[model samples]
Target: MIGAFCGSFDPLTLGHVDIIERASRLVDTLYVFVAVNSEKRSMYSLDQRLAWLEAACAGLPNVRCAVQNGLVVDACRKAGARVLFRGIRNGQDCAYEQNMAFMNGYLDPDVETVCLFTKPEYDLYSSSNVRELVKYHQDVAKFVPACVLKTLLEQEEMDENIN
Candidate 1:
């Protein structure tokens, strides 16, 4: 089955990569969907996030990244995906994702949502938290892939200047 993972992925953290990798193995094809939330201010632009995602998942031939604005179920339909892949870190995340799954079901019952519990090591890391750490110049090499870290480092000066 074709599967889709949808998220902002502002900086494409390793935790996100882990989910993509595992999900890629479970389905014939995996689409990494990045929502273009116009109301949300992101550390990285949609293009940067998509590029980072592409770079991070370069090793996985079945994984593809796309940016779109609208309901995730619509994106899933466009990709011809039959499953929506999600990662849950805790009860809170589970509850949130469950609600989303329910809504997705309402949108299209043909697609199913599969939530994976986060690996303990990655449970505490998220794009927002990692972005906060980066803003303070804390080492984030451990939280993201080498390519993502490189982009962060390369754009560090620009970020500082903007701030």
Candidate 2:
């Protein structure tokens, strides 16, 4: 079965990678949809986000990365995915995902939403937190994937040089 996992992924975190790895195992093909919203300001560009996702999922042959311009259900429909994969880290995430799953179900009944609870080790990791840490010059090696870390470091170096 084909599954779709959608996220803004301004910077791909290890928590996201863990979900992707687990989700890929459950489905024949897992599409990592990078949902881009112009209204929301992101630390990374869409192309950078897509590249990080691709690099993070390089080991998973069944995982593919794609850009999502609109609703997640629409993206799933376009990709012909029957399952929508999501990761829940806490009660807040659970509540939010539950509502989204309900809405996605209403939007596309053919696609089923699957919420996977995040592992304890990665439960605290979030892209927003990681971005904040990076902005403050805090070490985020454990929170993000190597590819994302490398790029972030490079960007920081470039910024430092410019300043």
Report the number of the highest-lDDT candidate.
2
Model 2: weakest 10-residue lDDT segment is: 36-45
CA deviation > 4 Å runs, candidate 1: 157-163
What are the per-residue Cα lDDT tens digits for candidate 2 across 76-138?
Answer: 999999999999999999999999999999998999999999999999999999988998999
Clashing pairs in 2: none
**lDDT by residue for model 1 (12-46), tens:** 88888899999999999999988876666888888
Q: State each model's C-alpha RMSD to the native.
A: 1.9, 1.0
Stretches of candidate 2 off by over 4 Å are: none
Model 1 clash tally, residue pairs: 0
